[model samples]
Target: MESCLPILLHSLCFVSLVLQISYASDSISAGQNITDGQTIVSAGGNFQLGFFSPGNSKNRYVGIWYKISAGTVVWIANQENPLNDSSGVLKLTPQGVLTLLNHTDGIVWFSNVSRSTQNPLAQLLDSVNFVVREANDNDLDDAIWQSFDHPCNSLLAGMKFGIDRAKGLDRYLTSWKSVDDPSPGDFTYKLDSSGYPQLILRNGSVVQFRSGPWNGLRFSGFPQLKPNPVYSFGFVFNQNEIYYYFNILNSSVRQMLVLNDNGISQRLTWVDRTHDWRLYASGPTDECDTYALCGGNGNCNMASSPKCVCLTGFVPKYPSDWESMDWLNGCVRRMELNCQGGDKFLKFTNVKLPDTRLSWFNKSMNLQECKQTCLRNCSCTAYSNLDISGRGSGCLLWFGELMDIRQFDENGQDIYVRMAASEVGKILAFSRQSHSEDLELPLFDIITIVNATNNFSDNNKLGEGGFGAVYKGVLENGQEIAVKRLSENSRQGPVEFKNEVVYIAKLQHRNLVKILGCCIEQDEKMLIYEFLPNRSLDCLIFNQEEGVSLDWPKRFTIINGVASGLLYLHRDSRLRIIHRDLKAENILLDMEMNAKISDFGLARSFGGNESEGSTKRVVGTFGYMSPEYAINGLYSVKSDVFSFGVLVLEIVSGKRNRGFTHPDNRLSLLGHAWTLSRDQKFMELVDPSIASTLNPLEVLRSIHVALLCVQNDPHDRPEMLSVVMMLNGESTLPHPKQPGFFSEDSVSEASSSSGGKHQKIRPTR
Candidate 1:
């Protein structure tokens, strides 16, 4: 052999040795072998297919990964079958089949294909898909097979994750047995198509989590699936196929959704800076995400303390078990159903619709027709709009007891559950109203509420306001709640209730208080909210002892938090809202002392291009009202900025705007703050309680921004965005002009900015 190599250096054997030793990072022709030391990269150099040993494992396997991030495997070809040594060879046959051979030339793994072709060639494309097709043909449809069709744990962009019903071919993700071992694990994330198609994560035969049924927008339980800059996603269910796919929008970004060895499905994105993967999102995030955590006929809420409760018409089947927090026993109907004649359907809103495996859906039926169909069929337990898109059409009906029910504060589909006729009348006031359909909030029963608050005991009362008396309550399941009972003598009535429901039900943010449910029965109108342990800002700032508890850092946090909440209401919310009554009294503090804005009863929403609205009657707290809103009866997003400015000054000084008096002058808090700002003595306005713990610059900046927000001219007042920027120290401050309502002039006798008094609150013009 040595004599032949020197004499005939350009022989076929020499050529074969060159192919084996040198790297050929592209397509591999038939009869060629990519041995252990050799690898092939995609045409665009984004992906590379080669032999890899993950982690501490000695055994090697064939896989694909991003060339930009080494060792980050996305797809493993022989995950379940690893080679014992480096003698492994990956070969493509003329039959268009790809085979992995061991040292003995025995096949370790081979691609399964129904057909074969001549001149077959395997090439790695930039999309990360390794395909085997005829060398002359490039179309994917005509190819024999592809690695994407048999995914191992990784679901890359532009790959389908469902079943091709026509061909009975299913594509899914499976977890690795261990980090060091690439063999298949116990968990698999796949699309189940028993009735409607929903994503499910399972541990062998046991179901761990379900992604709820797909409404046109997103999976019901998956709120993290929102619009993002990285990718666009969709689910398709046609006669031939049913699958979910995501296409990356930014070509420079690399991402994949994978089922990890721990059975958690996570979406990971490659970050160039870190040179590693970032966890974009993951499923089964909380206890509510547990499959049927509350069992059948029960509701689970994350914000609520105990997190589970029976549906309106149901009660715990085992009282002792429920008291012990063993909710697996579930709930049962309080009254017997009198078949179709004596039963009525009660609508449950903002909820993860129950398990769809025991469900049936029709594409042609409208919502009204869907309700009627459920009524006629005695076995039908519930029904909802199958597709919640456009005006919403199609029907999905659930039979037997409902399971896996959960409640969300916003963006959830509605379902109508059957109940006894007697139980339905108690909530008829809400269901019969035309506006009720848009209030995407749950409904609480009078019986449960009455028991929780001990029939509105004054001892349990939290506070009283123009709205109503608020009583704190604890449900049978140990969930804490705050109930606001409307007074019979109060002028605030239905309009205020509707405004609060419509606005807060659809609005979601960390800085906003969450409404749990509402009660309209037994001659009562009430709203239920999550119980915040720290209560309102007024409760603390007005009290000398409690005020000391709020140090400089906490006060600054509250000020910044209120500004962000107001910014969300004015600009970032689903609809543009003008809060006419944003004051320190309406700012609530949670257990962590983080602030959340509350009381949306006087909030007004404007549609697109309609920035401002005018009203004949004006109503708001006197000290917090802006000049334009108080006098001209015109309100805009700037009006809320004015109130926020007042709040900021009050928080810093530990003084209330109304009934505030300076020892040397008749100036209110606003006038005092403006004087301090004008003199460059803003540090004098800092609350004495926080004097020892203050940052002089932050305090000065807060005072400066507050003056700008309270400027007399609406145009002079910065928008909430600018207010936020100034508060965050992101933008330089603009000197503020004269603030509104600074003098001691009588508001009753209108002179400049103050107008004639309004007869009532929120009287729609």
Candidate 2:
């Protein structure tokens, strides 16, 4: 009996070894399964293919799960079509395809990867991806096909999530139908690479949210995206494909990109000590993260309560509807597109960039060549750099309306918008004509603005602009000047040059910027202007420490000084011009807080008896444009009046109108002050930095006049002359009405424009 027992044990051990060998061998065929419930773990133990019921469900489904974690399913072979009984078999065909057959039903699930080879084997690699290849091909790169190309809700480390242009097959991740069901759901995550690579989360055809375009470092839309030691991101762009993939930098950290049931994506990693996954980051943090919340050609600032706004060239389509918080309609262009030979391009800087779906690209063209190409093609509406790396080369042009534009403090791309050449000429003539008025600096003997900027050092940078950057310099003469050097391959061009010269030369005022001279030689167009020691008004008004130093006396002096400056333009200047773009940043401060308006890139001119005029092309910033000017392309001194009102409120509060959060109401500073002044609580609206040190009567008077100037109806709003007179107690101010975009409730009205293709919101340039 003992001898018989030894023989039985030896036979059992040999049987176990044989089964292990069969499992690892490539000859095991599919029809030879023996059990009711079974699983085949890959030879490398990286993945397991089997049939299992999810949660407590009675129905069974064939799936691929992690071998290390049996419950962690990565791919399901039959998610939507589940078998009622456990009679399923997963088999690889000779044609390099995977097929799941059922005993009860003839066909269950199948993977169809077309291959010419007759002898094929299915294997799971260490990356947990299932692949099928020719049995004779030792080179894994020659895989006949792979399941990783078609992902479910999970994005593995090396998987490509983009379109196969040749096959028109777009590989995207669809969310699980439910928490318990692994079936596909309405939500899908697709890599939109039409213009750039941006991860868009969509519910059916509608976009639920978006991850801004992938900048050189990270996604531009997500400011929180920073360097993480756990993973590294890579973007692949070529003629055939555009894909975004990530690799685990730390082998010890197991991380996954998962689209959960509620549509939140979390990049989670396992923590050994905690014995659980730690959340690294999540998307859709704020309202602005939603796809095109504000509308086309709009900018969004999350710091502000009502985060959506139009860019400089657009206005609300339905102003009343937008004021009601229905932003789906988006905004309309204040300036009409004539598309004539007179059309020009306006450059917007430091922006996240609009959607590039209807755009064309060229890799070798410079900015000048790109502009010429776009100008020749009337269909081209805008143009920008295809790649913003290494001094920025390549060109991308947009046809039709520019949509979904947003400003980012970091990793912003430049876009040149189409406008009337006459309009552009008006802007160019200002700078160009003024430039020649002064003695021209010698061509070849010019000092690079960078050298003047101390080798273009960041520490020496005076300020930045749409054209390029400004640096304070003292050219050997010990005479200080602000050098405006054009960025390499910048959007601003000769037209902008001519505009600056023509417009600024004819105008003369103590409160206006004076052009000393210019250097236009060898790809460089540098504007040399009289350097103001105190710098821009934004440097003082928005700085906490600097703002505290601006006492009531100083604030009053600045208010009066700015008023006089506007008065000179509206009533005193020979041209009777309208500074379409009037904002805190454009107001230059001298040694004594005296204000000087600068940057006429967007300003428009008017002749005698020109109280009002219409333009097909509207150009100005948001939060300052009057309803008529922003919506109907109508402009006059009244437009400047609205801007002045906004400027006054901003200076007094030391906060930008774009991100201003109303405490008791969801209204802009102009609107909130109007409400408060109407209720005699205007003093509460003063900036805390200057509140304690301001004159109550003067501040109240200024606030009242500002409100009167920002009235919803352009006619109801006081002109710059009346506003200045009221500020100086020379005229009695009238009661103000509800300002455009003012909100009475805590729920502010969303901007009328959406971040979609058609509607765009113009910003206060």
Candidate 3:
């Protein structure tokens, strides 16, 4: 009986050992094997490659997905091919390339590439991109090929979406055939570098939509691209490649730009808080978004009652059809042209110019020379500076009809339209007599800029601007910087061009903005400045939702800091400066929300005994400019003092000085604030966002000081020194006088520039 028991125990132990070895055999390796239910995990456990079916489809495909997030499929071995059953095998050859085979050993998909070494390895990077290379060489430049370089419809962070010009490999996104089918679909997105670089979506050989050319700021097509917390965008255009890519701002965040089966491109970002994905942005928001809805020689503006309008010289090709809203026929020139008759060019402002695909370019020609060159060739319909930097160097001539024009109220490109000869003569005579001059800025070479902003990717954007865009960058070793690239058609250019460089460069102060350097190359003029990461104060103090975070102490500190900065600009700086455009947006915040005056684009530097300078141009913005400056073109340091007063009141009230409101008088922020202060209802003016965090005494004192600054009599306004001292609680403030343009009894008729009208709200035209 004892002998029989020993035999049974030994049999049980042998069975257990055999079962363990069988389970281990299902593991995967280079020459070993993997079957239907098996997967090969990368070294860091970041990626998993195996056979799996997608979205309930029984068609088994060999693919790679993140190990941490099992649902994130990054690459697929069989996008066009699939196995009938689960009997699939994935293997890495000794030569380095990976291959997948079906149950019959038929090659399903194989990565074919030249291998330098006898032994090689396949690696999946921490960024979730898979690569193949020689055993000892991990450098990307020396690699054979990578799955990242050959992406499907999904564009993940760290992936490039552009042309590999040298390799003749143009990477783009192709939509899926259908929800259940993984085959390529009709729509394809690619980087078109014909003139300037632009993102274009195509249906076969026809373009469906365009993301517009990179206009030194955001894409001309996407006005909604603004400051966001999750990711940053960038474009690379050098000798090696011309690509557009984006990266996750947070390392833990996962995001993807995918073209789904529905022919829509969507950007999806993972939200850890919800344990789900969130939509970041969507394109083609309206019918006008359909590529060139107005067709050739036409402009589209959603805000307009009729979105489509023909160019100045063009009339509808089919008048009856066009009136009925069918504009596909586009437009035709109203008059025949004879170049010998002295052809004229009409100026179109605030518009995304026509496409430059079939255009001729010369980097040396200015706008004037460009006009002559276009006239010399009868085929030339329009001509412009190929590059819009440094007095406008370069000439690009268009011979064909202009296509895909759109209006952008904030930042649009300038394009001159061809007109009859007599029209040019009349316009040219009028312009030459008025003596308006163009501003010139130095342009930065494409390479020098690449080294400046790490190629101007999303990570570099400081924030969006009304005229253009700003980016933060670092030079070699360590020189932090901010770069502002102005749009070509910004109405505020010439003044801003002079104010930022000529004025700010000559003045110096700790509290004022600093100019580091300038770049001028071809048409790319950029101003380099010291980078400030805390962004502008408006992002913090006025955001009712975000203002709650600034407690009483922080608010008090900010108030004092701004006063100090203004004092330096107004009194202590080398030149007694009047920040004519003083507003919340002009005040930048440091890491501590410490105020530093910036955007001196409208600032005036006064010499000895000279208190102010006025211009008929009326350059500053509506909300921030003093009433005298906005209404009568009369400006003085006292004018700036009035603007400062408005800013101070806004800080106390946590409201915008330009767009403030009240039910009784319908006055702007300044009027409402004055009324509340005079009635001892000043506490009511404090922003509700920071109500719980403010001290009543400090708030009241700041409001009083603000009222004194806005006094109607320029003689009664206090100097910045007095204002700063009052904020410090070091000196007694004077009693307030009647505020400028602040009468509650007689409401000013509201008017706006560019035909916009509102009630009781006077705006700078």
RMSD of 2: 22.1
Question: What is the clash count of model 2?
Answer: 52
lDDT of 2 by residue, 1-765 (tens): 000000001123322432343344322232334223455556655565656656556677766655444455667777788887767776666565677777754777787665556677666665767677777775766876677777777776777777767645678777776656778877788888766567788888988776656545555555555567877777776667777777888766676677765676766665668755566667666676676777766666553224555544466667676566666667666567675566667655556666666767777888778988998987887887766656567788877766666655334566777765432322222223233222112121254445656876777687665567787775432335687777775445565565555556556566777664466656777776767787777778889898887777887887887788788878876567777878777887766667777776566666655678887665556666677766667888888888888888887877877667677556766667777787888877788877668788788888888877777788898777777778988456677888765753311222233111121121111
Query: Which tens-of-lDDT digit does each residue in 1-765 have in candidate 1?
Result: 000000001123323433465454678989988888677878887877777677677787888777666456778788878998989999988787899999999989999999999889899999989999999999998878898888888888888899987767899888888778879889888899998889888899898888899998889887667788999989999999999899999998888887878887778777889877777887778889888888889899886667888887788889898888899978998887887497777767678989999899999999989988988888899999998878799999999889999987557777888888766543223232124442334567888889999998998888876666888898776778888888887556687787776677667776888776788876688888878888889888878899999998999999989888888888877667888888877888887899988888778987678778888767777777887778878898888988999999999999888778678987878888999888988888888988999988888888999999988888899888887788777567788998887764533233244454433321110
**CA RMSD per model (angstroms):** 7.3, 22.1, 17.3
lDDT of 3 by residue, 445-562 (tens): 4565678787878787776555566777655323456888766754446656656765554454445555544665566657776566667767777787777777777777877877
Which pairs, if any, clash in model 1? none
Total clashing pairs for each candidate = 0, 52, 13
Name the best candidate (by lDDT).
1
Worst 10-residue stretch by lDDT in candidate 2? 1-10
Ranking by lDDT: 1, 3, 2
Which candidate has the top score in TM-score? Answer: 1
